[model samples]
Structure formats: structure tokens, C-alpha cells
Target chain A: MAARPADTPRGRVPRAEREQQMLDAAVLVFSRRGFHHANMDEIAELSGVSKPMVYAYLGTKEELFIACLRRESARLVAGLAAAADPTLPPDQQLWRGLKGFFEFVGAHRDGWSVLYRQARTQQPFSVEVAAMRESVVEVITDRLDAALRLEGRQVKPDDLTAMALTLVGASESLADWLADHPDEDPGRTATRLMNAVWLGADQLMRGVSWRPPA
Target chain B: MAARPADTPRGRVPRAEREQQMLDAAVLVFSRRGFHHANMDEIAELSGVSKPMVYAYLGTKEELFIACLRRESARLVAGLAAAADPTLPPDQQLWRGLKGFFEFVGAHRDGWSVLYRQARTQQPFSVEVAAMRESVVEVITDRLDAALRLEGRQVKPDDLTAMALTLVGASESLADWLADHPDEDPGRTATRLMNAVWLGADQLMRGVSWRPPA
Candidate 1:
């Protein structure tokens, strides 16, 4: 608690700010090296904090991993919700939402890939990923519901859930691919998905079906 | 190596047949109990084989698990490839393919859920899941390509890859949902995805876009 003579200036940094820096460093290292192979010393070095200090703040390796999962999940959920304006047209809203999601994944591809791959499949940690996914699905469902209501159209709750699930599933799949392909453009990926799903949604909602060409 | 007089009745069962029975038991036990909770004794009991025989045949627990994965993955991939006939129209082919997939997952829901959850995110085991996914993606891509060619329309390989990824991802997402919801019918699930995606694919391929309604 006491500031030594050598720790006066930067040591004055708030605990919260220092924690965020450590998380950022953790995300970077975890994404690059994976959880098992990653070391605390590297994370500390990256964060410019002492190893002892890192331990003091984050507790342990397992706890630090969970903390990273929580922060990353929160960031993804927040980014998605903020992307679409409620007042916008349905298609525009969907477009913005998809764009925001891919852009976020593209920017943090390594982190997203590592965190998602680890948490979604591993026990105890998967809960964090599930929570994030549920939040995302809810956001999309709300947007679609509001958009439908604007057109004086209402669908069954089951139908809405299925639609949201479809979009979410497809987006997650493509996002996984995007994460692996660094050369791929996030905006373009978003646009490609928008083109397919938006078109399909418009048709399906109106009771249209795709028949084989004659 | 010597067959006892007491074992004479069913001991005539061929080694391959007995191996198949053991594998069948392993799949059932693994699906129901999971790798960690499942014990070799239950599998041996189900197969009507002794614990030592099971161990001798399958080698070890980890090896048995991998064998189960290989068998399951082969079954799934074969099911998908066999579902769609080349003579059928593209839409029919796609419908059949999707139906086959959902049906396979439905029949083996517990197995798929546990195996996919465990393999896709974990070390070593994930390779099995990855191989299965690759096979599925390839099957879908070939179907799309052949169908497009029939109409004298061909897309860039990247576009095709993207399209295939979209379908694979969405189906997987919904499939995961189906595994959890035992009351849901896989056939109906397949139809739902077919309806949405087939419509989208047709329109998108022909240069049609969904514009926001005024």
C-alpha cells in the first residue's frame, strides 16, 4: 500500500486502470501462446507490471484465464449491441449489427479464436462463452422483433428464436473462418453474410421458398 | 487363445463381429456417460465381453475414445455424402443432404453433443472434429459447385467456400440446439434450414439483393 521512492509516479496509476492493462496483456499472450503454454512472466512483461504485482492483482493462472474470458465476452456483447441503432430500418439494423460483430472479431481475431475455442468446448470455462452467446442472441432477437413490429407483422416467438439461431450460428461459423484467415476483410465478410441472410430473411418472412430452376 | 467349453456357444462369433459389438457398446456408453464418467466395465458388460478382452482389443481408455470418434465421424460423413443423389435437381439434392445431416445428428444426438463439445475445443481430440468438419464442408462445396454448373452458372471458389461455411455453421448451431432439445424433430429442423438457406442461395446467385422496404 505504501509507495516506495522508485514507485511514486506510475505507481499512482489507479488499481482499475492497472487491472485493465494486465487483462489486455493477458489477452494478447493467451491468444498467441494458448492457455497451457502461456507463462505469467510474459504477461507481466507485456503489461509492464512486476510478476508479483500481476499475481497480487489477478490471483492465479486459472483465475486470470477466466477474467480474460469475462472481459472479452463483455466486450463482444457490448460491441454488437452498440452497432445497430434501434430507429434504423430492419435491413440496415441487421447490416450494422453483422458489420459490428465481424469488425470486432477481425480486430481481435486471435483473442476471439483462442477464447472462443477454449471456453466453448472446455468445462467450467464454457459458461462464460455461453453467457455471451445468449446475450448476443437476445440482442438480435429484439432487433428482429422490433423491425417486424414496424411492418405491422408479428411472428411466433419460436420462429423468432429459430431465425436468430440461424443468423447466430452462421455468423459464428464465418467468424471462426475469418479469425483464421488474417488476409480476409471483416467488412467484406459481414457484407457477404448480409447479402445471403438479409435476402433469405426478406423472402422467408414473406412466405417465399426457393425452387430449383426449370 | 483357447476357447473354453463353456464359451463354445457364442464364442463362434468372429473377431470382427465381436469388435463391432464392443464398439457399439463403447459408443452407447460414451454418449450416455461421457468419457470421464464412463467406465470400461459397463462397455464390457454391454458387449458381453470380459474386461481383459475389452482392454486387449481396444488397448486403453484414450484409444477406445479415439476409436469411437473415428467410427462416428465416418458414419456422419458417409451419411451426408450418400444422402444426395447426383441425378436429383440441385434443390432436391440440398434438401436431402440437410435432412441426412440432421437425421444423423438426431439419431446420435448425445454422442455428437459430447464428442463435438469435447473435441472442438480441447487439445489432440479437436483434430477429429476438425477432420469431420472439413469433410462436411467439402461435400457441401462439391454439391453447390455441381448444381451451379448445371445452370451454366459458376461462382468464385472463395464465394463457394463462404457459402458452404455459412450453411455448415448455421446447421451446426441449430444442430447443437437440437441435441439439447429432445422433443424437437430433426426432419422439421432440416426443413427449416432448407427453407431459409435455399431461398437465400437462389436469389444471391442470380445477382438479386434484398433491399429495405420503404
Candidate 2:
């Protein structure tokens, strides 16, 4: 396949733009070929850059894969952060965050697959991906804490973290489901998750709990 | 490393017992080497069987991986089923299932990793692994439906399935976390999930919904 033109007037592309181009190519390649099978040679070819340029810009295939993960993760996190309005009630904030998340995943299916599916499965990248996931969880945990404080309700920090992690996990799994079933609406996915989590969380905040029938 | 004796009699072993042994070896190897890197030769060496024997018993590497997934998934499902007493209320049934799930993961980290972390990321094995996850979700969905019915409340069937999927995803993610932090209590993980999911579910059953503060 003929390479896509690399930015601008023809000869030399700016470093920033070139880096983005390489990352775009790397995400596609890594998503298509599982990390082990994906090669820098193909990535370079697809990015319309030389092999040495690819190395100079990204270091190694591992680094390039991590770069792709970080970029996609940052985009996702930033999108959620932008969508969540703190002034709004906690549930609305969560709804906005979920909507941003599903929309991002729906738009960037390859990025979602690479970060959540491919990068996560490999052992070497686990720490990096875990850190990314932790940041998202931390955001959720903070929100849950803030919401609880508003109601004068207290919960253990660990419990809050677990709740945050579960919310993140549920969103992720549903995002994967959304990724596969492209016809499914992201808004509906977001609503489904919001209903599952927020309603449950609101109950917990009210000190309501389910007990086994005697 | 010297292989463990498949059967102590130094003669032909029963097919069922021998299959279990091979499956155990396959789970370890697959978890360590991943499906692509894992080979029949290493599996045979680990299982104290010949390469031909490995193929004859399990068919091929793909089939062997699927067999391993099936076995692990079955064990997990069985454990949950056994723990969840139908005589108990739905919340308690869910609690029991979650407890059984965490206990199973804590006891069999390798099996959990293979079925969840390793097998799930690859494209070729998605269908098989998905089916395994679906069964667990189906069980959760049924319980949620039953509980809702007992409460004289009703929700869309699709919503019930979505809730079940979220719970499964949350539990699986927490299980992954439990596998990583070996010291973390599985019961605590289960409780955290029960709090996050069941509380919200009960609230929804009572027609409680969270809306943005006016």
C-alpha cells in the first residue's frame, strides 16, 4: 500500500506532527498484530518515515507501544475530565464521564482495543497500564469521596477505592462490548452503566443495605 | 525440571485423570508462555507425556487452550453454584457467589490469570472466553430477575443483563486485583463488590433514581 503523505509542503515534517503520525501508525499496527508480532519496520513504512527516524522518535517497539497506550489513555482521561462538571451533582458528573468514555472508545476503536485488550494482556506492559487505570480510579475515588462528604456519610477509603475500581472495570468491559457491537449506541451503554453504578451508590450513601432474608 | 508422575502405577493411567493432569500443566504453561509462545513439547514435558500423547489427548494447541479455559471456567462456575444456596435471599446468594469467586481466584491464581488475563486479550480466543463469561453473567442476571420479581418490581430484561454484566466485570477486575495483591482478603473484595452492586440494585428495585441536584 502506498504510504500516506506525511504532513505539509513535501520535504521535511515538523517533529511534533511526525511523532503523531508515527503514533497513529503504531496504534493501528499494534492493534492489528498482537504486540509480539508487530514490527517497527512495518510501523515505519506505514508512518511514511524511515526506520531510523522511527527509532529516533520512539526508541523501541516496546516504547512505541507504551507511547501509544499513554497517548490514548491521556486522550480518554482528558475527555472524561473535560466532560465531568464538578458543579453538577455527582451522578451527573459520572454520567458525563461515562458518556465521554464511551464516545471516545466508539470513535477510537483501535485505540480502545490496543490499550484495554492488547497492552493489558502482555506481562511487560502490565505496570504501565495499571498505572493508567489507577489514575482513572483515583479520579473516581475522589469523586465518590466528595459526594459522600456532601451527605455527611463516611466510608472506609479502601471501600471507596474498590467501588471506584469496580465502576472503572464495569465501564471498561461494557466499552469492550461496545467496541465489538458497533451498532450499539454509546449513549445507551453510558446510561446502562450509570443506572447500575449511581443508583447502587446512592443507596449505599443513604445507609441502605441488602441483607439475606431470615 | 523432571516431570511429575502422571499416575503412580507406572502403567497406563485412566483417561479422565490423565486429561486433568495435562490440563493442569497446560494452564501453567499457557499462563507463563502465553498461547502463541506455549508449545506442545513443553506442555508434554511438564505433563510427563510425549508430544504425540499431548496432541492425541488434547488435539492441538488451540484446542488445548480452549480445554484449559473450559476446565477453569467450569471450576469457577461450579464453585459459585455450590456456594450460592438458592434457599438464601438474592443478596445473600450474590454474596455467597462473590465469596466463592474470590476464594477460587485466591486458591487458583494461575487458572484465573489464564482464563481472564491471557485468554481474553487474543482475538482467536475471544469467542470461547466470552461464552464462559456469559454463563456467569446469565447466572447473575437470573438472580437479579428473581430478586426483582420478589420485590414486586420489574425492569427491562436488557437492563437486568447490563447490570449482571457490570457486576461480572467488576468482580473479575477485583479478582485480578486480588490475584496481584496476594495479602488482600477475598472476602473483603467480595463485600466491596456486593456493596457497590447490590446496594444500587436494591435502590433501583425500589424505584430510586439519582438525578442532578436541581
Which number leads on TM-score?
1
- For the predicted complex of model 2, DockQ is 0.33
Question: Where does the lowest 10-residue lDDT sum fall in candidate 1 chain B?
Answer: B205-214
Q: Write the per-residue lDDT of candidate 1 for residues B1-214, one digit (tens) a residue.
A: 8754545655688888888889999988887887888899999999888999999888887788888888888888788889888888666777788888888889888887877766665557777778888888988888878877776676678767887888899898888888888988887787667655765633433434332112
Tens-digit per-residue lDDT, A1-214, candidate 1: 6644544565678899889989999998988898888999999998888899999999898899999988887887788778778887666777788888898889988887888886776667777677778888888778778777777677677656767888899999899889999999997888778656765633433434332112
Model 1 clashing residue pairs (backbone)? none
Q: Give a tens-digit lDDT track for model 2, residues B1-214.
A: 4664546662567788788989989988988887878888899988887889889989999999989989888888888778777777666777888888998898877667766777766656767888898899887778777766766667687767777789888987898888888888888788777666756633422334332112
- After TM-score superposition, the amount by which residue B124's alpha carbon in candidate 2 deviates from its true location, in angstroms, is 5.1
Q: All candidates' lDDT scores? A: 0.79, 0.77
Q: Distance (Å) between predicted and true CA of A61, model 1?
A: 1.2
Best by lDDT: 1
Judge the docking of candidate 1 as incorrect, acceptable, medium or high: acceptable
Stretches of candidate 2 exceeding 4 Å from the true structure:
A1-13, A25-55, A59-63, A122-127, A150-154, A201-214, B1-13, B24-56, B59-65, B85-87, B121-127, B149-154, B201-214
